[model samples]
Target: MTNKPTALPARPHFSSGPCAKRPGWTPQQLATESLGRSHRSKLGKARLQHAITLTREILGVPDTHRIAIVPASDTGAYEMAMWTMLGARPVTALAWESFGEGWVTDAVKQLKLNPTVITAPYGELPDLAAIDFGHDVLFTANGTTSGVRVPDYDWVPEAREGLTFADATSAVFAQPVDWAKCDVLTYSWQKVLGGEGGHGMLILGPRAVERLESYTSAWPLPKIFRLVAKGKLTEGVFAGETINTPSMLAVEDYIDALEWAQSIGGLTALMARADANAAALDAWVRRTPWVEHLAKNAASRSNTSVCLVLPGLAEDKVKAIVSLLEKEKAAYDIGAYRDAPPGLRIWCGATVDTADVLALTGWLDWAYAQVTAA
Candidate 1:
C-alpha cells in the first residue's frame, strides 16, 4: 500500500474561476480610498480609469483598442458584445466545452440569429481551417473546462470581413494573444488575475467599434448591454464611466492584481509563471500510470485550468479521490468541472507557485492509491 504523503501544498486553492490570489496577497493590500464612494465620484472614476490604463500597459494592448469595465464578470462582457453586435452579419459559433455551448445557445435560441454552429467533443478543438471568416466568429480562447486551448492565433486570418469575438476569460494573462486577429475580446477579473468577482473587462478593436457605430441589433438591448448611444460608441464607458454601478472593493482588488503583474516584469513574466506551473504538473502526469491529460493534443493543452482523467476508473471512484483530497486538506477545489468528464482539474495560473503544484502531486498519488484500493 502507498503511504500517505507527509508534505502538503502550502496553499491549496485550485479553483479555476476566482482562482488562487497572487502570491502574498491580502485584503489589507488593496487600496481603500475608492471604497464607500460613489462610482461616479472623481476618486472612483480615476481609480477605474487607472485600472484600464494598467491593463493596457501590462497586456500591451494597442491604443487602437478600447477597454472597459462591464457587469456580471466574463459572461456579461461576452453577452453584451453578442447582444449588441452579432446580428450585423452571418455568425459562426464554435464549441468544445460548456461555456462555448452557452454562447451557441445564445446565438441560436436567444438572439435567433440562426448562426452556423461548429463543435468538437470535450478534449478536442473544432477544425480552425473550416471556419468561414466572412461571418462573425465566436470562440473561447481557452476551454477552461476541458483543458484545451488554441496553440496560437496563426490560423485566424489577418484580413477578414467579419468580427472575431473571443471569450478569453481564462487565457488573458497566461496565454499569448495576437491582438490584431481579434476584434472583440472579453475577460473577467476573477479568472487568471485571481481577483474578486462580479466585474468584467471588454476590449474592442477598431473593427468592433466600427461595427457598433454602423450596425444596430434588431432586438432591444438591456440598459446594461448598451455600449453605443446616438449611433456612436459610448466613449465615457471606455474611459472609466461604467454603464452600471461597480464594486469599488472589487475594482481595487483587480488593480492590485494588475500592479502585481507589472511588478513581476509584466506579461512575459506572467506567462512564464503559468508555463512553469503547468510544466511541473505535466511532468507528474507523464510519470503517473493511472492519469492522462484530457486534452490529447499537447499543443492545444491549456496552461491554466489543466484537466486530467483517470483511465478506466469509474466516475464514482474519481469523485472519491476528490473527496479524499479535500478531506485531508491536501488540495481544494481541484475536482473536474461538473459538466466535464469525471476526473481532476488543477489550476496552474500565474498566481500559483510551482512548488505547491509539485507538492500536490504526492498527495494525488496517495489519494489515488487510497480510492482505487477500495
Candidate 2:
C-alpha cells in the first residue's frame, strides 16, 4: 500500500475556471477606490481603461486591434461576436470538446447560419488543412475540457476573405497567440488570470472592425450584443465605456492580476511559468504506469488544463478517486469535466506553482492506490 503524502499543496485550487489566484494574492491586495463608485464615473472609467491598456501591453496586442470589457465572461464575448458578425459570410465551426460543440449548436440552431461543422473526438484536433478560410471560422484556441490545443497559428493563411473568431479564454496569457491571424478574439478575467468572474475581454483586429461597420445581422440583436450604432462601431466601448454596467470590484481585481503579470516580466514570463508547471505534471504522467494524458499529441496538449485518464478504469472508479482527493484536501476541483471522458484535470496555469503540482502528484499516487485497492 502507498502511504499518504505528508505535505499538501499550499493552495489546492486547481479548478480550470476561476482558477488558482496569482501567488500571494489576497482580497486586501485589490484596490478599493473603484469599489463603490459608479462605472461611468471618472475614476471608474479610468480604471477600466487602464485594464484595457495593460492587457494590450502585456499581451503585445498591436495598436491596430481594439480591446473592450464585456459582460457574462467569455461566453458572452464569444456570442456577442457571433451574433453581430457571423451572418454575413459562410461559417465553419470546429469542435473537439464541449465548449466547441456549444458554439456549433449556436451556429446551427440559434443563428440558423447552417455552418459547415468539422469535429474531432476528445483528445484530438480537427484537420487544420481541411478548413476553408473563405468562410468565417470559429474555433477554441485551447480545448478547456479535453486538454487539447492548436500547436500554433502557422496553419492559418496570412490573407483570407473571412474572419477568424478565436474563443481563446484559456489560451490568452499562457500561449502565444498570433494576433494577425485572429480577427475576433475573446477571453475572460476568470481564466488564466485567476481574477473574479462576470466580465470578459473582447479583442478586435482591423478586419473585425471593418466587418462591424459594413455588415449588419439579419436577426434582432439584444441591447448588450450591439457593437455598432448608426452604422459605425461604438468607439467608446473600446475606450472603457462599457455597453452595460460592470462590476468595478472585478475590474480592480483584473487590473491587479495584469499588474502582477507585468511585474513578473510580462507575457514571456507568464508563458514560461505555465510551461514549467505543465512540464512538471507531464514528467509525472510519463513515469506513472496507471495514468496517461488525455491529449495524445504533445504538441496539441494544453499547458493550462492538463487532463489525465486512468486507462480501463470505470467511470464510477474515476469519480471515487476524485472524491477521495477532495475529502483529504490534497487537491480540489481536479476531476475531469463532466462532459469529458472520465479522468483527472489539473490546472497548470501561470498562477500555479510547479511545487504544488509536484506535491499533488504524490497525493494522486496515494489516492489511486487507495481507490484501486478497494
Candidate 3:
C-alpha cells in the first residue's frame, strides 16, 4: 500500500452497494425503542407505512400506483415482475448491459416468453424501432455496467397498448423517471439511497395492477413473489409490509436515508449533487488523453455509474492502476466489471461529494504516470 496521509473525512465509504450514507446522517434517527417488535404489529406497520408514503412523495409516483418492499434485492423484484407480467403478450426486451442481458435470457430460455431481443454494444443503444405497442416492453433505465442511460422516455411511443416494465435500479435518485411511461418499475435501496440491501422496491401502475389481477400465471407463484391474494391485488404490501419477515434494522436504515434525502432538499438537491459529480469527472476526462469515456455520447452517459476506458493501456495495466488507487486509499472499488473491457467504473451518485471525485481523479493522473513510467 502506498504511504499516504490518512486523515479521514467526517465520512468516506464508496462501496458500490451499501455506500456511504449521506453527509450528516446518524444512527440516532432510528427507533431503537421499537427494535424488538413484530414487523406485522401495529407499530411496525405504521413505521413501514410512513416510509412507503414518503417514498411515493419523493419519487413523484401517482396516487393510483402502489409501492411495495419485496423479498430479495433488485434482482428478486425484477424476477417477480418478469414471472408475473411476462408471457401475457409478445415482449420486447432491450438490453445494453449485463443485467439487461440476464433478463433477456430468462425471458427466452427460462420462462419461454416469446420475445424479440434488441441489443446494442457497450457504448451504443439499439434501434428504438420495431417496438410494437401490442407487446410488453422491458428495459433498464440506466445501464449500470456500461454507465450509459437512455436520454429520456421519448423512445417509448405515446400510444401503447401493452405495459412498460423498467428496471431503474441505479437510476432512481440521480435520473428523472416519468412514472407515466412505465407500468412496472423496480429498484433497490443500496444504489442511490445508500441503504443496506435486503429488500427491493416495486412500483405498479394501474395497468400493471390490472394485469396482476386478471392474468393467470402458467407457473405457480411463490408466497414471497405473489402480488395478488384471493384474486385481488394486495395494494397494502407496497407500504413497507413484506410477504415475509424483513430486517427492521435495514428498514430503519432505509428510513434514515430517506429522511436525510428530504432534509437535504429532496430530489432536486440529490440530482444536482449527481450532476456536479459527473461534470467534475467529465472535465477531468476531457483534459486527460490517456483515458476516455466508455459511452460515445455525452448526453447518454450516466451520472451514477460513470465508466471510462484507457486508450492504449493493456488490460493488466488498467487493472494495476485500479489496484494502486485502492491500495493508496485514493479510491475504492473503481475497477471495471469483468465482462466489460479494461477501464474504470466510478460511482458518481448523490452520496458522493464532487470534491472527493476531483481528488480521486487527481490521484488517477499521478497513479497512471508512475505505472506507465515503470
Candidate 2 on 329-364: residue-level lDDT in tens? Answer: 888999999999999999999999999999999999
List ranges where model 2 is wrong by over 4 Å.
none
Comparing 2 with 3 on TM-score, the higher-scoring candidate is: 2
lDDT of 1 by residue, 36-94 (tens): 99999999999999999999999989999999999999999999999999998999999
**Which candidate model has the greater lDDT, 2 or 3?**
2
Pitting candidate 1 against candidate 3, the one with the higher lDDT is 1
Candidate 1 deviant stretches above 4 angstroms? none
Per-prediction tally of clashes? 0, 0, 2
Ranking the candidates on lDDT from highest down gives: 2, 1, 3
Clash count in backbone of candidate 1: 0
Query: 30 in model 3: Cα distance from truth in Å?
Result: 3.1
lDDT of model 2 at position 281: 96
Worst-scoring 10-residue span by lDDT in model 2: 322-331
TM-scores vs. true structure, each candidate: 0.99, 0.99, 0.95
Cα RMSD to the true fold for all candidates: 0.7, 0.6, 2.2
How does candidate 1 score on lDDT? 0.95
lDDT of 2 at 150: 95
**Candidate 1's error at 40, in angstroms?**
0.9
